[model samples]
Target: MLARNDQNSLRRTPLYGLHVSLGGKMVPFAGYEMPVQYPAGVLKEHLHTRTAAGLFDVSHMGQIALRPKSGRVEDAAKALERLVPQDIMALAPGRQRYAQFTNEDGGILDDLMVANFGDHLFLVVNAACKAEDEAHLRAHLSDDCTIDSLADRALIALQGPKAEFVLAKFCAEAPSMKFMDAGPHKVDGIECFVSRSGYTGEDGFEISVPAGDAERLAKALLENSDVLPIGLGARDSLRLEAGLCLYGHDIDTTTTPVEAALEWSVQKSRRTGGARAGGFPGAEKILSQFDQGASRRRVGLRAEGRAPVREGAPLFADATSGEPIGKVTSGGFGPSLNAPVAMGYVPTAQSALGTQLFAEVRGQRLALQVAAMPFVKNTYKR
Candidate 1:
C-alpha cells in the first residue's frame, strides 16, 4: 500500500522539477524524490511505455567500479567472481549479467547488475543496500581487486517500443546492439555507457552518464513526444507484469536465488569452475537447493475478481479454512490485463500451474489461480 503523501529524506534527481512541471506525482522511493506517476496515471503510463517510450530516473541506484590490481579484464573478472555466483570470466566484453551479493547463510544481501567494462566491472546495486554491499565486497575481495563507489554517475532508463529509436538520436551505433550488450558512447556530447537492457520487458537502454550532464541528457530524450517521463508507480507495475523481482519487496537476505526462481543467473561453468568457481558465502546450501529442490518457489497468480490484491496479502490453501501457504510480494491492477494480478511464493506442492490459492484481501479470500509468469507478452526486439 503506497501513501499518496511524500516521505523522502533523500535528494532529488536532476529531472525532479521537469517531472513536476509535466504533472508527475512525486513520491519518495529508495531515499530519492521520484515520480510515481504522471498526468497520464499508472495505466496510461504502463501502456504508453509498452507502445511507445518511457524515461525513468533510476539514478537512486548505487553505481560502483571494481578495478583489478592487475588492471586486466580477464584477471579482474576472476577475482570478482569469488564474491558472486555468475561466471564473469566467460562474460563477453560489452555484456552484462544479473547477480546477487550473498551472505554466509546462502541469503541474498542484494541483487545487482554487473557489466564487464573491458578493464573494470561496472556494478549497479540497490541504493538502500549499497553501503552494506560495498562493505561486504571490500571485506572479502582479494587484494587483487579494488572496489570504489561512483558517486558522480546518474542512471537513466529509456524503455519501451520506441526506445531504440529515441536512443538513436544520441548514439548512431546503438540500434544494432542486442539486449544486455553495453558500450561506451556519447549521448548529446555527454560520454556515457549504454546498455540495451531494462526491467520493463521491453527493448530499452540503461544509460550511465556523468551526474553533471544527466539533466541535459534527460531533456534531450524527452524532446521526442514518443518518450515520456514515467514514474515509480508505473515502473513497479511494469516490472511486476514482466515477472522481474524487486529487491527488498520480492527478495531479501533470507531468500536464495534458487528459491526465488533466479537460477538462470548462475552459469553451469561457474558452478564447476577453476579460479572463478561458485565459492561465495553459503555456496553449500545454495548448491544443495539447486540439486535437491527448494521448499517454496516464486510464482505468478491471477485473481478471480476485479479487486486488486496488494503486497503483504496473505495466501491460503483454499477459500475456506487452510493454513497460510505464502504471501504476495508484488500485486496490482495490471494495465495490460485490465484485471488484478499478483506474484508471490508458495509451497512447492501448491506451485504447479493452475493450482488454486486464496488471497486474503479486505477480510475476504479471493480465489487466485497459478499462472505462467509475464502476465503480459514481452515485446523485446529479440
Candidate 2:
C-alpha cells in the first residue's frame, strides 16, 4: 500500500473536497492524498461498516477497458488469458473474477479484478502497479484488443450489511446483484459500473462512475443515515480482518500464488490435462506446485496478547530459538474481533490450524498461534 511518490507529487481524487469537508484526516497513500480516517476515527468507522454502511473513495485504483477487435468478449478474454492464470474465456458477462498477473517465475506481479462486460473486458488493478500494468497490457495484448484506460472514472465502495438497502434506494438493480456481479447500471441517476464485491468481507457495491459525477454520487450515498465516510485506515483493517492480501505486503513479485495460499483462485481449466492449460506465465512451475506442494504457505496468526504483531516481525518455530522460521507480512488489531490478528508465510508443516509459533516484536518473542482466517466472518451476498 506504499508508493515512492513524494508529498509534492501526490495526486488527489475527485472526492478530495468531500473528504476534507467531512473532517477526514488526509494522508499520503499509494501516491495519492487520501483520507486515513474521518472525524469518527478508525475504530468507529470500522465498526460502523460492520453494523451499518461505510463509503470509501477508491478512485486511486487503475481502471482499464479492453475492446476486442473482433467485437466479441471471448476474443478479449482469450487475449487476457496470456497474462493471468484465471480462466478468463469462461467468465460470464456481468461476472468478475479475482486474478493475478504473474511473472515467468510464477511470482505475482499484481492481483486484480477482471469483469466481463459483454462487448469488452474491464479491469481494476492496484494503484501503485497501475502504470506498469497498463504498459504490460499494451505491450502484450494490444494486437487483439483496443486497450483504453478509464482515467475519467472515479470508484467508490459502499460496504456493509446495510449497503444493499442503502444502494437499492437509488438503483433498483442493486439487490439483484450477487457477489462478483459487475456491469453498467444507473446509480442515483448517474451512470456507473456497479459491482457486488468489495475489499472488506461485507455485502457491498463498488460504483465506478464518471469523475464529474463522483462527488454527486458520493454525496447521495453519504446522505443516507446508515452511511458514513470511511478512509484508508478502516479499509486496511477491514480487509486484514477479512484475511485479504494487500498487494505489496501479503503478495508480491517475490511470492507465487501457490505459496501465498491463493491456489483456489487458479481455475481447473488452467491446470494440467485441461483444455488450453499452462499457456500463461509461470505455468510450468505453478502447475508443478499444485501437486508438489510449496515449502511455505501463508497462514493466519493469532497473537497471545493485546499488543499487535506488526509486519516485518520475524517468526520462529520455538519461543527461544534464535533462528527465524518465517515473517509476518500483514498484522494489526482487528476491530471486529477485538484482538490482534496477522497473516504471514510459515513452513507447510507449521501452517496447520493449531500450530504454535512466535513473533519477534520490539526485541521480544511473543507467542502466536496459527489460526483460522477471516478473523471476522464474511457476509457476502451469496
Candidate 3:
C-alpha cells in the first residue's frame, strides 16, 4: 500500500528504501516522504514500543552545535539563556534539558533539546523550524557563540520498556545513564552519541551519528529480536500519550509557554521578581501573564465515545453548548488509553481534571472530560 514514486514532491530520508523494505507505509511529513506506519500498523507499533523496543528514524530533525571560540561554557550558556528560559548555565556536562526558543513577544518559537557537551552545546531543533531557528540564533546570540548546523548527521531513537536491556548488549555502559543524560558511545561498532531520553515517555535513547552510517546502524538494531522499525504514525500516538508537544501542532508562534502548560519548564529563578526577570524575549509579557494569570490553559481530554477528535476540532464549554472556548491541538485514538484521547486549550475555569467539555468531531458534539496528561505512566529510566 506504499508508493515509492510518490516521493517526487517530498524530501527523502537516507533510510527511505530501508523503511519501505521494512514494510513502512510512507507518507509526506515535514516536507519529507517518510514512514507513517508499518506492517504492524500504528496501534501495534505503538504498543510494541511500550512493551519491547522500537527504533525510529528521526534524522529529519535539525541537529546544531553552538561553539564558543574560547570554549567557555558559562559564557555560551548565559548567552543562550537570553533567548530561552532554561538555566543553560546550570546544565552539567553530559546532561540535557528540554527548552523553548522564544520570540520577542514571549511566544514560543520552537521547543528543542539542548545538551551540554564538554566543548559545545549540542542541540536538536524541530525539523520544520530548522532554518528559522538558525537564523534567529545567528541574528541575536552573542558573537562569542558560533552556530554550526550538523546537517550531515542523522538521528534515530530506540525506545521501549526494554530499551536499556537491548542497548546494553552493544554498549554496556549506557545502562548507567539516567533520563536526559547523553554521551558518546559505540553501539555495535557504530560511533554515536546516545541520550537516555525519548518523546514517548519511555526509557530510550536518541542516537546521533554520521548520516551515511544510519542505514547500517538501523540494520544492526533490527537484528535484535526485540526491536522493530517504528513509523511516524505510532510516534505521534506515543508522544500524545506521553503528553509531549509537537512543534507546529501543540505550540507555535502564538502560543506562550505558560498557557501551553509549560510553565513548569520555566525555572522559578527566572519567574517574575526572581533574579532573572524579563531578560529573554517577551519577558515582560510572559511575566505579566504569570502575574495576571492566563485566561486559557492547555489540558488533556478523554472522549466518552470511541470516535476520535482530530486537530482543529472545536471545543465547547458545555456538552449542550455554552460557547466556543478552545480547540483541540493533538487528538487521536490512543492505543494505550484504549479510547480516544486529545490535548487542547480551554478556559482556566474549565481546565481542571474533572471539568467537562465538548469536542465537535464531524459536527457531532462528544462529551469530553479534562484529564491529566501522560494518560500512561512514564517509565523513564531514572
Candidate 4:
C-alpha cells in the first residue's frame, strides 16, 4: 500500500478531519492520505482489535454499481461472470462473494468483493486499482450494464469479537446477518450497505454509508469503551496475522489465482466441465493449472527466532545456498502469536508443512519453516 511518488497530491477521505482530531498519523497510501496508526500505536491497536473491537476508515477503497439494462439482477450476474471466474449467477440476493479480475494470462489484475443487492451489483475494489477496475468493467460489460462509481459513499469496518455487540445497538439487523450476508440497512437512520464480511478474519461488518454521515457514525462507534480507532498500520498487521493477501505485495498481474493459494475462491461451478465453466478471461490458462498444478505456490513461514523478516527478503533453500528460490511478500511480528510470521511464494515441493527454509535478512540467513496460515484462529460467524 506504499505510494512512492508524491504526498502532496494525495486525496483525503471524508473522515480525514476526524482522523486528525483522533491523533491519527497520516501517511501516503494508494494516492490517499490515510491513517497509519492512532496515538495508541500499532502494537496496542493491533491487540485491542483482537480483544475488543477496532473501527477502520476504509473510504479510500473504490465502490461501484453495476445495474443491468434488462432490470434483472441475473443479467448483471451474467455480465460480471464474463470478467471474473466466480459463480456470480449462483450468488443469491443479499449475498457477497470474493472475486478477482484476471488478465489474458490468468494473472490477477485486482481482487474485489461483489455483492448482490437485488436491483444491482455493488463492488468494492482496492484503492490503487479501482480506476483500472472501473475502466475494465466499462470496456467489457457496458453493453448491457450501467457502470457507475459510487463516489458519495464511504466505507468503514468495525472488526473484532465485540463488533456485533456494538453495531447491533444501532442496527437491529446486524445480529441476524450470517457471513456473506449483505444488503441495504439503516444504521442510525442512515441507509447504508452493510456486509457481514471484512478483511480481518474476525466476525465483523463493512458498512457503506453516505459520505456525510461517516464521521458521526465513526464517532458514535468510538464512544463505546471497547471500540478503538485503528489505522492502516494495525489494519495491515491484523490482516497479515489473518493470512490474507495484500493486493500488490502478495498478488499482482504477474501472479495467478491458482499460484496465490486462492483456488478455493474460484467456485466449482466455474471450473473444469461445470455448466458455466470456461467463460471468463484466462479461462484456458487458469483452468488448465487446476488440472496440472502451478509451479510456485504461496505459503506461510514461521520464523525460528524473534527477529521479523521484512518484505523483499530473499528466501533460500538452505543457509549455504547463494541464490534465492523465493522472496517474502508480507512479513511482520504477530501480536497474537508473539512471534514473527511471513508469507511468500515457493516451489510446490517446498510448500508443504514443516519444510524448513532460510530467509536472507541483512547478512544473516534466518531459519524458517513452512507453516499453516491464519497464524491466529479465525472467528468468522458461520
Q: Which parts of model 2 have CA positions greater than 4 angstroms off?
A: 1-7
Poorest 10 consecutive residues of model 4 by lDDT? Answer: 1-10
lDDT of each: 0.86, 0.94, 0.87, 0.93
Error of 3 at 128 (Å): 0.6
The window of 10 residues in a row where model 2 has the poorest summed lDDT is: 1-10
Expressed as tens digits, the lDDT of each residue in 68-178 for candidate 2 is 999999999999999998999999999999999999999999999999999999999999999999999999998999999998999999999999999999999999999
For candidate 1, lDDT tens digit of each residue in 13-125? 66676778888887767777788888888888899999999999888888888888887878878877777787888888888888988777888889999999888888899
Q: Using alpha carbons, what is the TM-score of model 2?
A: 0.98
Evaluate residue 280 in candidate 4 and report its C-alpha lDDT on the 0 to 100 scale.
88
Please list the residue runs of candidate 1 whose C-alpha ends up more than 4 Å from where it truly belongs after superposition: 1-8, 272-277
Model 4's C-alpha root-mean-square deviation from the true structure amounts to 2.3
The C-alpha TM-scores of every prediction are 0.95, 0.98, 0.96, 0.98
Q: What is the per-residue lDDT of model 3 for residues 336-382, given as tens digits with 9 covering 90 to 100?
A: 87998899999898888989889887778999899998889999977
